[model samples]
Target: MAESSGGPKKLLWVMIILVLLSSAGAAAAIYMVLDERDDDNPEAPSEEVVESKPPVFLTIEPFTVNLADDRHGTRLLYAGITLRVEDEATRELLETHMPQVRSRLLTVLSGQEAGQLTSSEGKQQLAAAINERLSEPFDENQPPPELREVLFTEFIVQ
Candidate 1:
């Protein structure tokens, strides 16, 4: 009876030792796999930081013009325009020759038909026309001012 009890105790101790060794081995394998993954994928190079410049805007006073009587009778357009210029120098150039700028704008605006002013395409066309006209040099000797875009703040047709 004593021998039988001692044999059972020895078997239990061996089983416990086997379980502990297996658990340690599994933990070591998992750690090695994670470490290998970290080594395989080195940290990505940091992205380059770019310096961006702010846009410069020049606002023109609102314009009221008589639309062409092509399809309607004596229609009018009241539009507020803001000009995006490439630099301060172009804005200064426009400020210096405001009378000529207004004249050119009025000529283009007065020619637009009431029917044409109602659609988005017409508005885009109008902006393009304004851009083209404004891009022309104010003086024969000077180069044209760099006009980036023409934005309409308000548009009303009656």
Candidate 2:
């Protein structure tokens, strides 16, 4: 009877020792995984060492254009125009060709009625067309000037 009780106690002790050893091994593996991650990224990047690019500047000129046709039975036609151009060269090119731009815009807008211009989709289409026309003069090989956006500052039809 005494020997049987001792055998069971030894079995319990063996199980306890195995459980402790397994837990210690799992802890060691976890520590090694964390340490390996630390070694991968030994140094952090310095914020001060980074440099950023300067923002590009854009300018617009307000235009009040007169349409040829009087769709609304009135002679007055007014539109606020803005041009989005990139550098000085492109700006100069647009400035030099102001008469052409005006002519092109007049031709494009003259066909549209007051109701068409009032719609959001109409305005977006018009802007896209205008952008396309404006970029026509630039060489196809080189990147065209980035037209930021077209805004209708003031639109009046009479």
lDDT value for model 1? 0.93
- Relative to the true structure, how large is the alpha-carbon lDDT of every model? 0.93, 0.66
Return the clash pairs for model 1, or none: none
Instruction: Choose the strongest candidate by lDDT.
Output: 1
lDDT of 1 by residue, 1-158 (tens): 34566887899999999999999999999999998997787585547888887898989999999998875589999999999999999999999999999999999999999988899999999999999999999888999999999999999999
Provide the TM-score for each candidate, comma-separated: 0.69, 0.51
lDDT of 2 at 96: 66
Residue 40 Cα positional deviation in candidate 1, in Å, after optimal superposition: 21
Question: Which lDDT value does model 2 have at 145?
Answer: 54
Show where candidate 1 strays beyond 4 Å.
Answer: 1-47
lDDT of 2 by residue, 71-120 (tens): 46534446776765665666676666677767776776666656556688
Q: What is the lDDT of candidate 2?
A: 0.66
Q: Indicate the worst ten consecutive residues by lDDT in candidate 2.
A: 53-62
